[model samples]
Target: MTLARLAELHGVATAYEPSEGVTVQVPDATVVAVLGALDVDATTPEAVAAALGAARRATEDRLLPPTLVRWRDDGPVRPPEDLPPGTRLRVTTEEGEVVEGLDWQPLPLGVHRVEALAPDGRAGGSTLIVAPARVPRPERRVFGLLAQLYSVLSSRSWGMGDLGDLRELASWAGRTHGAGFVQVNPLHAAVPGAPTDPSPYRPSSRRFPDPVHLRIEDIPEYGFLAPEYRDARDAVLADAAELRERVLRKGALIDRDAVWDVKRRALELLQTVELGPGRRAEYRDFLAERGRALEDHATYCALAERHGHHWRSWPEELRDPRSATAVVRADDELTARVDFHCRLAWLTDRQLAAAAEAAREAGMAVGIVHDLAVGVHPDGSDAWARQDAFAAGMSVGAPPDAFNARGQDWGLPPWRPDALAASGYAPYRGLLRELLRHAGALRIDHVMGLFRLWWVPEGREPTEGTYVRYDSEAMLAVLALEAHRASALVIGEDLGTVEPGVRERLARRGVLGTSVLWFERDWSGTGRPLAPEEWRTDCVATATTHDLPSTAARLSGDHVALRHRLGLLTGDLGRERALDAAEVGDWLTYLERLGLLPEGPGDEEAEVRAVHRFLLRTPAAMVGVWLPDAVGDRRPQNLPGTWDQYPNWRLPVAGPEGQPMSLEELAASPRLHRLLSVFGSLAEHRAEPGTGAGAGSAAGSRTAPPDARPV
Candidate 1:
């Protein structure tokens, strides 16, 4: 009882329901570990009781929560309960400007500090967040192309796709097909290691773009290099060319480390070329803007180069990012490396800006829609720099359900609720601001995390974890404020098992939800395909995602076979195939009835076209077409639940025949152009089903082969 009370005060769950009526009590041990992560002492009953008492006392004494929200459009700003009348209020705005008033008043949309003083001289202060009532929404309905940037390689790319490819792809798509935006995977920085984790969802730093994604030749210094560095730079370029050939032609996987190695060498050479006056000024401004955060990140990188990626494994004195000893230990060599990394971050930022600019120049309404991963890698720069914010020795994951009986652990560190509130969600706000730096819309991966997250204790199975509630109001307020400030839209990836009322809250805030075509069924009732009109209007509708199979594979029932080959299927292969085929068949039949699938069921390309047509019929504000689906790509960029056994994130976007393609080839492909033509008349909000050129012209891949076992 005492323990439960303590847990409740800390926003830790004592129990949870995986489904409607099945409640599972969390283990006492797991609760203790989580409490410890939040810096709460819950090891014994006596400690818990004391903690509970302290919490009650704190609650009774506090004038406000660690943070407060003042929605600008709300009627009257209410004061915290029991605040004596005649209390004076003073607000320190985000810009450090102070505003005093007899009582709280309507303030600008920004984070501010609030102070209170009563007649008795008692003083109280709390962080006050003044934000808009809702986030920005798209001005006009739009259709966009979705691609994993790394997989969308071009002839000029060095093994994997880079920002240059993003620029060219966005320009062509927006100008040629009237694409409003181009969505890509997270370009967050990877933790340096012998073999870096390829999963972008678990990156070292979400605040900075990965330097590996930089197009080497695009660096201004590369073109202006001194003669002495030319030989070395050319050698790296040659190596990069060879590496590119190996992947695009020789059927090798995309080697991220190898690509980074070459890029690093090239960067080293570019660093030697002195900057011109204007360029130097830009660099200086970047340094000043990034300030301490950039310095800490660079210091981590430099230290990691010598002591390895894990900060804990480094010398004891250097474990803390701001340790005095660590500062003293920094030598000329280390300082030089730190500056080098800082330069790389600036260059990546510049290129990201350029890509966004190109999209705008091509008339895209919403340019580059960036992805925001749920959490950061435990051993990365983010964890090292802001150790105070993250819950140590705990991982964020999902509870067990139909998908995986044993549950799953994502291995990413979650932000501690206590710390987040204490810091007024500064870390969260800053992360959003940096990501929105060059984004038109930010897609939050697993956005339910704003409300609560399942926290699995270290060395425990994911099944034993319990949910930890976050102040969703504060979370959403911070998110809305950031998005509003940037004049960007917010799209929440609200897929998988979601709690009731979650979607409603997100909608109320004007945050768009993600609606995948296959999963938007009326499961609680008829379990039939949800009608186009019945679909949610506030969402980014799509046929598939990177974690899921490509539309080609989904329609052709090839994804099941691929999963079977990798032993990812829990049920009989035959059973799985039937289930997949039936789902595909249901949708195909539904499309035909709606006049969306004029070519009927059997033709694969026609079926894929039908899916998009069905999507367009829905009232969703945005529709995204998987770039791989444009051409007849049968391979998934990523396959969850399998790591090394399957080359999850390494495969290049391939054709239906499983051959690699350059972005140039994809752009020129008639199939791609034909599919995009469906939206040629989208501005009119009515694209005739079979009016797109080349519909039913060819049957490249059948949704279900004739030779397949009968469904």
Candidate 2:
């Protein structure tokens, strides 16, 4: 009982409801393990009593919570009324201004420091977050393209899609298809070395992007390569062409390692090029702006090059980024490598900004919606640098649910809620600021994590994990403040078994929710498809996501066969097939009933169009067209349960017959054009003014000036 109380005191769950009428207590061992991760020991009865008493005494003696949030729109800061009498307060604004009275009138929109001095001479300080009422929203109703950028390779790219491809895709989609935005998977830097983890969700560091996505030709120095470099450059160009052909023509899987090998060699050559005076200045400015965060990441890459990507295996002193800084500067070789990595970061940043600029110039109402992965790989750059910010010996995962009866361990380290709050959420604020810099909107993957996360001990199954809650008010406040500064929309991937009220809370903060057509059913009632009018206005309505089967696969019942082929089906194949078929049939039937689809039996292609047409009919603020769905791709980019069983995150966008298609081919694809025609041709489906509805015909809506900012 003491252990349970201690766990509860630290926001660790003792029990949870997997379903409405069911409850299961977390294993006592799991509770103790989880508490241990939070630096509380409850191994034995004596320890539990001591820990619980210590926790109680600390709480009773504390002057304030670790963090407090003040929305400026709510008026002024309201100090905790429960503070002991004669507890004096002090406020220090982010701009370095001090306020003695604590009135905080005309509150600043930044993270501030609040100090409290008790009558008994006890003093404490807490992070005070001052933020906007909410993030920005698109003023106009619009529809956009959703794609996995790597899967959509252009002819000019080395092999996989690059920032150059992103720029071109955004420009063409905005100008030709009236796309208001193009959302893609995370471009965060990957764990370095060959045979890298393919999933974008498990990034090495969310701070920097992988340089493998750079377009060598876009670098100004590429055109000015000296004659001596021509031979090496030509070799890389030939290899790139071969790599691209291997995927697009030869039907080979997207070899990320091979692509990086080719890109890295070419980048090494590009690094040696002499920067002109103006260009040198630009580079210097970027370095100055990025400061220590950029330096720390570069240092990791430099060390990784010599010691390998896994930081733990390195020399003991090098494990901590702070200490490693001294070790790096002492060695000339490491310093040079760090500088090389820094250059790559600068180039990647430049190209990303270029992509955003392209979208803006193409009249996109919302340029690019960048995806933010939920957490970082446990052994990656972030974990090494921001060591104190994360929970040690614990991973972020899911409890047992319908998706996976065994639950899911993502192998990503979660931030320590205590550390984040103690640091004034500066780390969280910095991350959001970096992501939103060039984004028209930011998509937070697993957005529910802002509230709470399931923490599984290092050696435990995901099922053994218990939930640990965070200061959600502080989390959302930091997000709101950053998004407001960027004038960017916030979209939370509030999918899966969301805890009750999570979606509502996200919506209240002007954060858009993701609503897939297949899942928008009345689960509690008829289990029937939700009507268009019944869909919520605050969502990015779409037919599919990267994790789910493509529209063609779902309609043709091919996903079930694929799952069975891969040995991923836990149940009888026949029953699974029947259930899947019935589910698709229900959605198709609903589409017909809603008059979104033509009567009678439709072909697979027509069915795909009908599904998206249903999305447009909803009063959703934004509608997303899965890029592959526009074509006839039938494979999922990621198959959740099986890692090696399926070529997850390695397949290019292919045709109905599974032939990898190039960006040029997709642009000219008759099937894709036919599907998009629905978006541009629907007359009666036009959203009424002031409805916040979208999917306006692209035919006449392309009149916005090139300079028009994203709505």
Candidate 3:
């Protein structure tokens, strides 16, 4: 390839002028070998000359670097003063080969390693170790949340799902369902106010959990509160009871913000009581460790409430995170509020740790797989506290694709690779360690980002975005190192637009991949659904994912109608409907062929169950059943693209009639028991093969009628 083309492929600009005809001094034999690999006819003088010219041009353009240099009889040449570490140099003489100061021996063909040596009498040496790059890891098994902790049982929660519900769900999955793991959306701290953003992905601070998930009765301070405050708590409980009644009797969607408002009021009253010595000490340690970052975050929230949430609209003195004026202002007026937020974070951390403990107590093999969002909100605590870590004028988004012809701008800034490396990846490592502290596994959303991210410059359209490469080796190395230390499994959400070789690399490092039945296809050819046996075992295989419609919605074609209603359908409605119908028909036929679906008219819920049972057919180490789908809940918890036009994240999981089910109701429901029974049977069957009809049947048995088998 030409130098310009190589530079373009590497996403490097080639504009620097060569001062003195940049010399490339690789061994002649090595040059011949590389040229041969490229299929160049080096034996011919003209071809040899052309190859040499191309090599020199490539080096000059910084696309390639020489491996070794030769000298007839000259003494060792001094290295360049400006040469950065990892620059490779070799000296060879015609008389005899004398390689000195070589740091790396038996270096691979294309990989690079850096080494530095002292200048006192000893010579410095560095070598680039090159090897064939590996592929990224495949997806792992991941469970989805049916509802947030405080939001699960509306009647019992101060207005949301609480820790008690989580404990119950964990116990049920561990003992009854025999599930490997349970995953939840980010439980990160939310801004303390009305109309809080419900999307967990866009959190105020990832380091802390939202106190709204706390159950009032469960709080240690609840019993010690003043009688009047206790009565106030009772009133909140009464309000929550009504909300729960609405969900059960009238089918109401969850109100996350309203729940938070109630919880905040109760927590404020409870905060008055002094914590015991042990708890107080723990809180102090947390604050000490968090230090200025926590202070800054809390101060920002306090100032935001006063000056509006947007940082740009804040008072000029408070705009800068480190300004003395801002510090004075915070100390004078926002100290109490800042301390309150910090206290909330400490309590949430305790609860998160408790939840993980609950999972262990429940006999879960892997407890609490926490999800790390791709990025935080642009105006959130992370962005404010760690501004230098982010790219100044760029946004992270997707390039033009079939799903989004206009491309997508996620409206979140990305980390500058250069800055991250310079800081020794402290921020990344810290975040990982904190999340993994209470998690059995950590799911990294947008795993492809570790390799490279599409950087959309400010004011530029997504189509105009350019791919900014990151040091994938370093990134993966850090991840593996952290996972190894934590003894926690790593699951990379390697879903859309993956670059080649990323999966293989991740798998090699023992990280797991994600596989959704809907998207698992023979992309190479034949357009066939990927066989269960052919699926990678080191992955989380599931029937559906959070981003996609539930199996019920897909089978009933409710998703199609919903999209059309939202005016999100780009193609003609008739054409889209025909395609959708054909896809659903194909799935039904495939299921019937495998004896998974009955020939008779099947209910959407039953079909959905069968589809999950089909997923269990795969040899995947982990299988996630979306919690909502377990009880035949049709509405998705989230719908992308439209924000206010649709209730994106507020919907509570509902029954067939759209009435919400409380945690207690869900736990006791026969419907849920039936679904858990499927998982229980699968686990039992997996323990001893050929015992159950589901375990005995092959996934591809076309002639076996669904009624003839139990799988």
Q: Tens digits of per-residue lDDT for model 3 on 1-711?
A: 353333333332223211134422323332233233224445456776675677566544441122222121123333344544544545332223433444323332222323333433233433232222221221233233334354466456644576666766766666565555678777776654567777887777776566777656776877788776777778877777776666556656668877677677778888887888987898999999878767777777777767766776666767778882356464765777778878877777777777777666655556777888777777777777787787766677876554665567777778766567555566776777678778777788788788877666567676656565776766766665555555567777777666557777677656677777877767666767777677777677777666677777888888888889999888898898899888777777787788876633367766776787678787776678777777777776677777887776676666665677777777677776766565654444221111111000001111100010000
Q: Per-prediction count of colliding residue pairs?
A: 0, 1, 36
lDDT for every model?
0.84, 0.84, 0.62
Q: Which ranges in model 1 have alpha carbons more than 4 Å from their true place?
A: 76-78, 324-329, 683-711
Q: Work out candidate 1's RMSD over C-alphas.
A: 5.8
The reply for model 3, stretches above 4 Å from the true place, is: 1-117, 120-151, 191-194, 246-248, 324-333, 598-601, 685-711
Residue pairs with backbone overlap in model 1: none
Off by over 4 Å in 2: 681-711
Question: Among all windows of ten consecutive residues in candidate 2, which has the lowest summed lDDT?
Answer: 702-711
Give one digit per residue, the lDDT tens place, for model 1 in 392-442: 899999888776778879999899888898899998988999999898889
